[model samples]
Target: MTTCPLCGFEFDGTALSCHASCAFNERCAVICCPNCGYQMVDEQRSVVADRLRRWLARRNPPVREIGEVCALTELRPGQTGRVIEIDAENPVRSERLQVLGFVKDAEVYLLQTKPTYIVRVGFTEVSVEQSIGAGIKVLVG
Candidate 1:
């Protein structure tokens, strides 16, 4: 199933109709939204490329040891762990977390969970939305 990048509707990728006036529909790799008429380049190939790049980029994180992996929200106050992954679908959003020292291999401590998630990464305490917390996976020792 392909999701409409605009309206967040899930539908078959083969069902999208491209209304754009591009001259190369035969070679074009784009998906159009059926509901809102939004068009986006199909990123399946790019995702594969990204996966290959990540595989070659860095040494495996220290969090690779066998253990149960859970989202940041599952951590209680005073709990600590190493960030193993962030499940964000957008590169910009993932980079934003990286800027805040929430990247893989970073140590984090859960400071609070009420109203929102407050976690300490490095020397900074960051307030994060509950939904965003769900995207951050941590490896607890």
Candidate 2:
């Protein structure tokens, strides 16, 4: 779980938003200061940097990479396949993909990959260059 850098309040690791009434919702994840009721977003670059460092550290653990199901539309061009493993770290990308209603545990397939790899998910085909990351459970048949 991540702590509110501004208020020192602890929250769930997967939580992105603090609350609806938070003032910093426009800029960052809303985190309210319980003492002053000051609604703010944690914009500390160090926090992000630290998180990245941690991710890099855990990446080599050899966990069940791509063991969870995922959708085809979630894959994008020019992104590293390893991205899916760190979905929470990439909120912008996650949000973009989530808009399409594709989440973990969806089925997809790799079609072609020369100039760009095409992925077949559901009823559509998407071409991307980035590595789709691990932790996705896919069935090949």
Backbone clashes, each candidate: 0, 22
Task: Indicate which candidate wins on lDDT.
Answer: 1
Per-residue lDDT tens digits for candidate 2, residues 24-116, read 454554445554455554545346756877897764332222433343223333222322323435677666554533455445555654565
lDDT of 2 at 130: 46
Q: What lDDT is obtained when candidate 2 is compared to the true structure?
A: 0.47
| Residue pairs in collision within model 1 | none
For candidate 1, lDDT tens digit of each residue in 17-133? 555686765555677777777777666534655676688554222332335688887777777888999999899999999999998899999898777889999999999998888
Question: lDDT of candidate 1 vs native?
Answer: 0.79
Looking at model 1, residue 129 earns an lDDT score of: 94
Top TM-score: which candidate number? 1
